[model samples]
Target: MTSRDTLAPVFRDVRAVVFDTDGVITDSARVHAAAWKTAFDAHLRAHPPRDPRLRRPFDVRDDYLRHVDGKSRLDGAAAFLRARGLDTPEETVRAVAADKERLFTERLRAHGVDAYPGTVRLVRTLRRAGIPRAAASASRHAGELLARAGVLDLFDVLVDGGEAARLGLPGKPRPDLFLEAARRLGVPAPRAAVVEDALAGVEAGRRGGFALVIGVDRTGVPDTRQRLLRHGADIVVCDLGELVVRGEPK
Candidate 1:
């Protein structure tokens, strides 16, 4: 191993790396949040909350991270609705999720997302080091997102939401998706490292008994980093580049 790898010793034992697709690999989390906000705001307007505080609009940062990030559309919708004290009937949750999905799809097709340079660099470095890589996400559009960002070829395996659904795998905070990705890469959870931007994603990694859980906190908020740690992240970084060796070439 290189001297740089010694400094970040976690990589030495990691045989495979599983990455979360949205904020961790691509810049599409914000788009998802915006779409969620629009759908939720409309829902709230249509059916006003009884409590004044609950009437407040959805916060992309707080609400998204706490309730929706790393979760499936239906789960996310249900979580956020429950947080706001809204009725969470299955049909109601499905309706809101469908609306958010429509909005997100429209925005995505109109304006494609880009992969983070830092993440790409780290991925390439891992590849050069002969470590397998996987991209896993709760979004059904994960494959399209990666393809649009031109980085779909970087991963050795992709366990997207569609596959998860077909296989009856549960979403993040449950560890099924990441475990599946690692399994496809022929690596056990104990030998794989998981990189994630969502609280639930990191928790899943920890629960799955992964070798390392690196949290990406793009929010730039100190509390966000703390929250990630609290949620089971072994390490928290502002960007994936921080984990990259200084002299390593992309």
Candidate 2:
């Protein structure tokens, strides 16, 4: 039960914690990015842009981080298309989004995502410490993903895309979903900590007035850690393992 001295300074007063799903808890961000690349590349190939500069395929890193990550399916589709200078009609956007959804679902079912061991360790520690935890995500497949990864039971509450739609909550960067999750845990926003990997999610947590915003940088991508800071992450860690309790094995 010995807590990490580094984390003690930040999480000591935290009453609850909310986590973002994809890159934060599970290794599903790459799956989603791959699906987006497939769908966007297909669309671009079929309708070659008039400008040669826009002829390149989707970038799983730059494009994903800037436009799609932490966004709703339709929003992500529209954002990426808009970035390519395409003002497509509603049907076209929906079609592209649907294609991505299908591809992601197929990959997820075929090759399920696994929970990050560091995240799992922290979750277990939180549970033992009597801290309530909630997992919130913009993906409709969040529940299925968590169940598949065998981490569904780790959370005291889950506020995912399906639930967001039912409640008509606004997507990330707006703070609705995270707020709802904190509410369900019976914790005030200012007393809860938010853990996220995406820029939008970090911004949302900041906007939600959470006590602490933890940014997770799995790979230390170029400027990613800095971007997270710019988006309002109070602290940044390359791995949740950095926050593990002192008595725990690294």
Measured by lDDT, the strongest candidate is 1
* Cα lDDT tens digits for candidate 1, 158-204: 99999999999988899999999999999999999999999999999
Total clashes for model 2: 0
Runs of candidate 2 with Cα error greater than 4 angstroms are 1-8, 248-250
Global CA lDDT computed for model 2: 0.92
Q: What is the C-alpha RMSD of each candidate to the true structure, in Å?
A: 2.5, 2.3
What TM-score would candidate 2 get against the native? Answer: 0.95
- For candidate 2, write residues 129-216 as lDDT tens digits: 7899999999989999999999999999999999999999999899999999999999999999999998899999999999999999
TM-score of each: 0.96, 0.95
Candidate 1: where is the Cα deviation over 4 Å? 1-7, 248-250
